[model samples]
Target: MLDWLTSAALHAFGAPTTWAELLGFASGLLCVYLVVRQHIANWPIGIANNLLLMVAFWHVGLFGDAWLQVVYVGLGAYGWWRWGTGRVEQRVRSTTRAEWWWLAIAGVLLTVALWWYLDRWTESTVPGPDALTTAVSLLATYGQTRRLVESWWLWIAVDVVYVPLYGYKDLWLTALLYLVFLALCVLGLRAWREQLRTAPQGSPAWSMD
Candidate 1:
């Protein structure tokens, strides 16, 4: 079983693809689709995708990205809990300019720091770009838990960069998957904005809790 799993991750790294990649890919697409539909199930699906892709990235020596998937598992759980226990304060809301400024500062610091670390400590061929996306994605995941509409914008930006980054790494299917994510972000952005229109200003949008 272990050997089979190892081989799956090593298979082409998306030259054509493998069951591991396909599993991750499909779950990723479902997660995005659920996000569009405002379904809380996205988080669990995202966790599965993260685990599957972790192996896939590890086989290709994208250590930073590989470890990133592990981090995402934690983030996914937090997201699931937050959404499941939907509170009034967690409803779709606009971020203040002050919040945006702080987020920008932090995100930049994380990206630069991770870029330097990956460049020095890892054998990754594209550490700079990888770090950029990973940092942005972390913040984006946080934003989702906060129910911030701007998270979709961050995801849009990440997908744009990730497509070429994964493609250059020879993960062709993942690159294409990123394109799908890009489009889904567009859909999610619109859907969430519409939800914000109906969301009670100071009340939980749904009583999922």
Candidate 2:
């Protein structure tokens, strides 16, 4: 099964398109679509997407991205439970100013740390961008799980970088996937913004101060 998944399914843009990438591409699209609808199922489906992409990234020497998928698995599980328990409303809400500051600080720190590690210890060709996208992905995924309205913005930023980075790595299919993701992120942002504007006060939704 592993061999078949890693094997080339076809050729596209002069690169071998593997089954893992194809599956991951489909799951990635579905997962984001579910997320736009605020569906709880997105979490588990996203976990599956992570696993498939982990294999795809590993084969292409994107070690940072491969490890990121492992972390996303845990985060996805947590998100599943959080949404299931209804402890936090699935409605979109703005992050507090302080929360934004902390997220920004963490993103910067993680990017620098990942860049240093990947450059020093790994044979990664695009260590700088790999680390950047990995770090932003962590932050964005966490924000999405929290149902923050700003998470879509973060995803848009990551998708912009990912499209070119994957193309450079000869992951043309993955690059094209990010292009689709870029569009989805825009739609998600608009939808979430509308939700935030219309949510009633004193509802279960998290309030912005």
Candidate 3:
């Protein structure tokens, strides 16, 4: 696998060899940074990261992840528009705890659907886990695009599984990226909670009835 990640194989990344990966690497970092700041700019940066990663994953033959980037592209664009057009201020809803029943139902449905589709239809060797992670990630991204604070917890859940999955696939750098994402989720959660606390009395960030 080391051979697979060597400077030679990555010559497509250009003279620095790691340029493409670094573009992906840095954009991932920036996306997390912007999200932590609660800046709407995170969406564009997130879109950039997704596009870069789509290239990276396709090269590595992680087609599932490559397809996921496509979804992120669409979601990121929507998030950018929604946030930038003052729609966020108009619709900035407070986070509520997801009900235990709904959480259970979603979990079971996602797991089963991923397992069934991947195991039965895809040529992917790791399809079951890959599909499961992708499904949860889709849900998390959907929540994040809407600025739902609970999205971080969903990310946390997926990251825990994804780190091991990437490691198993010998994607050390990608695994490292997910590790940073996990930490950022924790930071983002704390930051957003504080924002909730300090929001104006009638602001949407506040949980007014």
Which candidate's TM-score is highest? 2
Residue-by-residue lDDT tens digits, candidate 2, 1-209: 88988999989998999999999999999999888888888899999999999999999999999999999999999988888888676577899999999999999999999999999999999899999999999999999888999999999999999999999988999999999999999999998898899978645543211
Pairing residues by index, what is the TM-score of model 2? 0.95
In candidate 2, stretches whose alpha carbon ends up further than 4 angstroms from where it belongs are 202-209
- Candidate rank order under TM-score: 2, 1, 3
Better of 1 and 3 by lDDT: 1
lDDT of each: 0.82, 0.91, 0.72
Candidate 3 is scored at a TM of 0.79
| lDDT for predicted candidate 3 compared with the true structure | 0.72
Selected candidate, larger lDDT, 2 vs 3: 2
Give lDDT tens digits, candidate 3, residues 6-84: 3333432123234445567788988887877767778888988887777766665566777889999998898777766
